[model samples]
Target: MTTLLLAAKAAVAVLLLASGGAKLADLAGFAGTVRLFAPARSSGWVVAAVRHAAVMIAAAELMVGAVSLCWPALTWVNLAVLTLTCGFVIAAGLGYARHRGRPCHCFGALTKRGFGLSSLLRAAVVLAAAIASCMPVRPAPQLHFTLVFHLLLLAGAVLMAAAAAAAAKALLTQPDSAGTVA
Candidate 1:
């Protein structure tokens, strides 16, 4: 069970790390796609700030996953990551469903991956893996209560929101290379 958990954690960590790294490196592509989704994409400061901050958040998530893999006992930390990640995927699925066939910048603009049923399925699989991993981690009854689970979720929400907000603020203020609003 521990071995399985470790393997899953490592795989997730690597995947997220790579994906996040790609986005961090290519801000323009991400910004362009986000321009499609973000209501304030037109604001040069907003887009630039958002692009860079999103990259940092992605990197942090990947790094956390990697470290958690090294310490399976830290599996609880994944509860937050998985839940938030699942939420992101589901949201993307909904967008694709409405748009019929939109490219999923979920990985970053660099990948050119599109969103669809496949994307939704992938999210479900990861969500399942995350839940399965927690099962073994909390074999004891009381230790696995909903409160503990929710607390982790709340933390994830706060962190993700904070990061997003910071990114937005930056985008609202940043200037283009020519000192013009991006």
Candidate 2:
């Protein structure tokens, strides 16, 4: 049971971190997509607000991932994961309903498809994993650091770094309307 919980926790942490890192990589592109769904995009202030909100959401996901990895035993961490998963589910549902064919920008550039049933299903599965991690269990006397666990963490870190680099490169090379990098 402990092993299962640890695996789930690790998986969720990796997912959150990867998603957050991807968003942080190309915040402008992410913000542009966000603006599409926003209720108001008429004013410059509103656009700025949307962009800021996008950054906040990404940062929140990253924080949650870090906390979950560092302290998986805490019930609050599990609850936070569950909450974030639920939010994702809801957001995917709403996006599917309204912006059915638009790119979700979920994994940054990795995922290009628009929100759909698949997106909802993915979120639901994550939510289930989060719930499973929340189930009551006797706390272990000490946290076990297995080879698999270490490998998982390492892989996640590498993926996040790669994604962030790609995003940064894209951001840096993006040309403004004046045909020059901003």
Candidate 3:
């Protein structure tokens, strides 16, 4: 049970870290996405505000990941994960409904995917994982296998992040038939 819990914590941590890192890597791109989602008309103030918000959101995700990784036993970390995932799910759902054709810009420049059902589904899965990780279970001694497993999971997350970046760079650079960036 402890092993399972630890694995879940590690998985979420890796995901959060990757997401935060990606946003930080391409703050300008992320700000553009934020502008697309914003209801207000684009202006100097709006652009600056979106940029700041993007940084704050990325920082929060990184902090959550760090806390979860460093103190897996802390229930608050799991709770924070769950809360953040839920918020993301709601935001994504709304974005999908309101902005049908705009790029999601979810993982920064890691993908040009649009916000849609898939976004909600992904968030749902992450929310479930966070919930399961938060559930009470009989505590057991941490084992070497757990450490190895989490390390592998983290590596997988990194690979996924790299793949996303490559895909976005390749796909997003191309223009649509209308000569607009897709």
Two-way TM-score contest, 2 vs 3, winner:
2
Q: Between 1 and 3, whose TM-score is larger?
A: 3
Ranking by TM-score: 2, 3, 1
Weakest 10 consecutive residues of candidate 2 by summed lDDT: 173-182
> How many steric clashes between backbone atoms does each model show?
7, 0, 0
Question: Candidate 2: lDDT of 169?
Answer: 48
lDDT by residue for model 2 over 53-137, one digit each (tens)? 8898778888787667755656788888889899889888888888776667776655565778999889888988888878765
For 1-182, candidate 3 gives per-residue lDDT tens digits of: 66676677778777887777677666777777677767666668877889999888877887787667655656777888888888788778887788755666667766656777888788888877788878775643342236666576456655655654455455545553222466
* Top candidate when judged by TM-score against the true structure: 2
* Candidate 2 deviant stretches above 4 angstroms: 142-182
How does candidate 3 score on lDDT? 0.71
Using lDDT as the measure, name the better of candidate 1 and candidate 2.
Answer: 2
RMSD (Cα, Å) for all candidates, in order, is 10.6, 6.3, 4.6
Ranking by lDDT: 2, 3, 1
Each prediction's whole-model lDDT (CA): 0.56, 0.74, 0.71
Candidate 2 or 3, higher lDDT?
Answer: 2
By summed lDDT, which 10 consecutive residues of candidate 1 come out lowest? 172-181
